[model samples]
Target chain A: MSNNYNTDGDRMIDCFLNLGELMLRAGAEVNRVEDTIRRIGHAYEFERVEIFTINNMISLTVISNDGRVYTQTRRVSVAAVDLEKVARANELSRQICAHPVPLEEFKARIADIAENTRHYGKRMRYIASVVSATAFTVFFGGNWVEALISGAVSIILVTCMLFSDRLKIRPIIAILVSAFVMTMCVQGVTHFVEAATMDSIIMGNIMLLIPGLALTTSIRDVITGDTVAGLMGICDALLKAFAIAVGCVSAMLIFK
Target chain B: MTYLVQIIAAVFSAIGFSLLFNIHGRKLIITAVGGAITWGVYLIVFTQTENVFLACFVATMAIMAFAEIMARIAKTPVIILLVPMLVPMVPGGDLYRMMTNLVMDNSGQVRFYGHQLVMEVGAIAFGIIVISTAMQLILKMHAHITEQRRARH
Candidate 1:
């Protein structure tokens, strides 16, 4: 057996990768998401773990369930200080990943698949929200310039996502970046395509942003009797769609 | 030749999309075949009725039936299978058409194009509803049949 002491940085990166996988399985079920956060936090021996979805509109539930030791939940939004909170989460992940700890340090995490799922879901939701928002920005402007700017924004966002391990950018920013990318895509297609045929060009591209998968999955969740999760997932999809529409309309008004 | 190509493409695309979404095995194959058959039905109905909306509605029902049969045989998740199956039918091109019309300032065909857009969106929604309802019914039937089979034994 290799007697190697893993550092905090190593644990954080492992959690980061696991977070992506968890999100896909659990979607946004807070219980599962909270569990995932707890497992990840415990791996680094952090006392508290909080994951939130902050958007331009609507307050979100902060689902915090401690393993009977520390648990709390509250409503939160993206205020000026929220940026600091995100920065803190990023810093913790970065610090932990930089200092890989002993393998035994993650024993709790290995035994806590439920927690991993929740944390992953929370992470994915954060990514999805931001991506949707950015897409909205480009969607509304609907011009060659808007498209170019959006494309640039998408490039930056995707770069950040790829290097999220090194950069320690929180998942929430990734969500916003996705929104930006969608916006850029719609606008960019419209920009390059002839003005006489821009409507189809824009519409075709924007369809990719449609939460068809989410919508269908939500209904399935409802049918399978996971009503709470289903309702929340549907609500999240609706809110995201509304946000994209709002961004689009706002930009259109500005451009017009 | 074009219609044949469309059918093959729809099937292959449905299968590929399903795989991307993590569907596999017999159910996945059923979905792919179903999508191809639905596409064929869509072509025939549209040619006969000359109503794209109606053709789409009929095609949706046909595929939903296929999905139900596959779900019953497999006893696996229906939505997981059904969703990827419907990917090919999603009106990506129609959406693009509407957006292009709006952007290009083509005032002459605005009314015609706008109506088509609405109809296409509606058709997609209609397809989803039919498939979900069919799945629910299939589940109930499977339960009932299992009970009967158990009693007979």
Candidate 2:
């Protein structure tokens, strides 16, 4: 056990940092990220653990029993909602706390999680987007014909979004462009189909663009007392909302 | 009958959103059910009171409870379930209407929709804060009791 303790501090720090980075990039809020990291440190018998996380970055320090300190900073640039990864990471941390694993095995497990791909394929995502748009139409009291139009428009919008994502375009730009394309498509479709209200179709498809998740998470964070993270989340959500509104209104003006 | 159809649609929409968020396996079903419950409650309350804020508050509380229970059962974080389920209750429609009214130069309609949007969003935030704070307190109490019991032993 003493031998195990000798070489494990650096490796454990690396493992913890990797785990925190994965959770952060998977779109976890700041409080969860900080809590998970602190728990993992405590489980590993670290003397002290201090973690500070912002919207896109995490900085941490861990001190061992022998006066050794380890500090690391990781930048998490991507923010995609992959709940499976978040769930998997959360489970891993819990397991680490409950049953201590060796350094080699822990590193391997973290690697496996980091490399995990999404369960659904691109085609499935497109289909799901269409289904969601159609359902929103019905929920908003649109008829079957209007729902169908919204579904078609959703297909176009998702395609544009995917293409923009591939090009690594800024998120706000991508949202603005997609919203513009969505409204333009709706306008064209309205000219062709009689009695198809533009409001319902646009509203249905635009639901996909609104930053609902971000807004909710921000509020939850603020209420939980992480005011800075909450403010950042709120700003991000509002920026996206503004981009979408500008896109839609610009399209409306051009079409009118 | 129509309410049933709408409920089904809400479920489908939630499943689709779960797929988009890459939530898989049995958790998908739980999240979908959460969405259905939220929408069902919202629809009933909205129809009775015709007040979006009250409906949103009640629906948000219901879903937060659902998410908390599901998280404990599945041993997953509550956010994985909460975010997707909350999608249907989001004030997307009001935001769009607010923007549309602005474009048409309808100042009165714009103000009306804008006010509604703010109230609904505020209601959602308020509901989440209440439930989250309550749950945190309960968990703390449980922890304290366990600690005291251990000390007695």
Candidate 3:
């Protein structure tokens, strides 16, 4: 969604590249992204297709029916955990493979999937953040009092996340800043809350920020032998984990 | 009380995650129940084997297989259910404790928890690889058997 470049080309190749870029941004594994592009290209009457995908870049080559070669590389954005987007992209790609569409229609459908599919409303997202963090607090053996505090702290965290997202902030800075602010808020509140340990509270909220998608996707990529993509995913997860740790440690130090 | 809390918490965590991921309809319920099953299986195996890695490995294989079956029925990608199903298996509490130990300069505790974390992650990766490879072989055998039948006929 960041860069829409090179609108003029074999529209069929454009659709293939667009779908690949969408799938990658939506956090599909590298294999899945490459598979989607190849399938879509062949379905559109391309004589042959070859694809190479990593965590953040996808390059594809298609030999059209006339044997003209069209090669395109799309720079993918950082992935997020919207399985809905992935599922939708997968379904769309499959449908196109079964019954190839005109390039114009293919482009439109891909754009619609990118923007207009029903996402969980903002309210639902906020509630989910609270419920998950609170349940995790109890699951982590926190007292009810600590669990309650974790719930309140999650709202503040979610707000920070949404605000940063709206302002188009980079994900790394958003994560690092939110983790620090949330931990500082938790520490400040627990000081007066009598017997509410900071450990369980922080543990519960940390679940919200953990790199679940990157970790899981990386595992799959590695298992599937996409070692480069897998390594990139691992690196991304490590950086995010480090940011969270630095944030927590700094906040704790502030109180110290 | 503790068992009940653990099961319910696992389910709710899955629900929360499913919603956050924008998963809709029956997929949401299946993914949430999948989380509870994962926790239940992990607890049973861990208590019996007293091995963290073994427990995680078994639990992961169980859930991934379950997701594969459900995905076939629902005609959705397996990752939809598989990812959220594994949420409860992550030791968020232990991870936080490890980071805290690092902050406090408790190197011994850091090493302990860090080792445990790596093992759990390794279990998940290996379990997934083993099952997927097995599934592929099964499919290949099935295809070969059908081909043989056609040739015989």
Highest TM-score against the true fold, candidate: 2
DockQ of 2: 0.78
C-alpha RMSD (angstroms) for model 1: 12.8
DockQ score for model 1, please?
A: 0.09
Q: Evaluate model 2: give its TM-score.
A: 0.96
Query: Candidate 1 lDDT, tens digit per residue, A1-256?
Result: 1122222333443444344233334233333334445555544444444443212211122222222232223332221111112222333334445553454543344335433212223343334333332333233334444434433444444444456535655444444444445445545555564542233223323443455455545655566455666677678765654444444444443334
DockQ of 3: 0.71
User: By lDDT, who's the top model here?
Assistant: 2
Return whichever of 1 and 2 wins on TM-score.
2
Compose the digit string of candidate 2's lDDT tens values, residues B1-153. Answer: 778878887887898899999998899899889989999999999999999999999999999988998999998999899988988887889889999989999999999998998888878888887888889999999999999999999
- Where is the poorest 10-residue window by lDDT in model 1 chain A? A78-87
| Candidate 2 global CA lDDT score | 0.88
**Tens-digit lDDT string for candidate 3 (B94-138):** 678899999899999999998988888888877777777788899
The prediction achieving the highest DockQ against the true structure is 2
